[model samples]
Target: MKKSTLLIILLFITIYTYAQRDQTNQEPGSTAFWENLSKLCGKSFEGEMLNASEKDQFYGKKLVMHVRTCEDGKITIPFHVGDDHSRTWVLTMEEGGMIKLKHDHRHEDGSEDRITQYGGTSSNSGMSKIQFFPADQETTDLIPYAATNVWWITLDETSFTYNLRRINNDTAINVKFDLTKEVETPPTPWGWED
Candidate 1:
């Protein structure tokens, strides 16, 4: 009888531990959105330009984004456009349940770009699959003309979309990647140690 009781207790403890892990992994409230994004770590996806009306030359090439690093409070994705591997998008969970997005651009020699680290922070805890970042004070100071920029990211089972629009200027950029099919992981982004 005592053996059976101990066996039941062990089983209950195991189930309880798993439940706690699940809860922490898919926490409620603000962390829900971040947890969704964190699911893509160590994966690469191919993308295409969604807003072809703009006729931008840079984005017309083969585009790939690799979700390289993921931690408790941060995820780093490197965006590669053709042969240029200079841009990395960093998503960091900030205090007050806010999320911050920063673009780190570098040159072939691993030097920082003149306009690097330009991104914004979330104004609210967005939906589980989408988050919007309005231009923060840092972006306005980096490039005054981009003061009205608003960036948003959406993630679902089939696709992930990154979007940008200048509220006052009508400038827009939309890039969508296929989440259903992951491509081969690309090389390290600029400035990253091998």
Candidate 2:
């Protein structure tokens, strides 16, 4: 009798779980739904100088990627060069949540530049590691598959800042992004994903 009762209880729980998931999928118009679709937003951080010693003599230029967005195991970074407008960076999550920043760039001439590798970092420990890939040869739906390079990102609520470096790229060396601003985190599409 005890075994039968336990089996019945388990069966009911399984049905309830499936019912909840189905409800979420077919729900009517909701801002929450749109928010859930957009996994990235509401992140802010301060940029700054980094220890040039990490790369040693091979250190690339200093740089910064501010207000980067990462959600659903992916991150799209938006950054501006010194007085040089801005460009979008796409990074994707890999095994262990390591970030491989897709190598891609747009020239002022509206042309695509070669994908070069620099270096990357993550704040939430090893949850994310910024590694370099060749170019957008392949990518997941989460990122630009054409990207020859990319990065992995782990989900975290706290804001993080990273110094940008261009290694083995045609750009100049010793460039760094100094964090000089702070902004409010806008509401997440998922509302409470934070």
The C-alpha lDDT values of all candidates are 0.88, 0.41
Q: Taking the tens digit of each residue's C-alpha lDDT, what string does model 1 give over 67-185?
A: 99998798999999998999999999999888999999999999999998999999987777888999889999999988989999988888999999998676678899999999998
Model 2 local distance difference test score: 0.41
lDDT of 2 by residue, 1-194 (tens): 99999999999999999999997675332222223323334344333333545555334422335445656655555554433323555555455433455434555554554533233422222312122233333333224432333233222233233323233443322323322344443222211122
lDDT of 1: 0.88
User: Which candidate leads in lDDT?
Assistant: 1
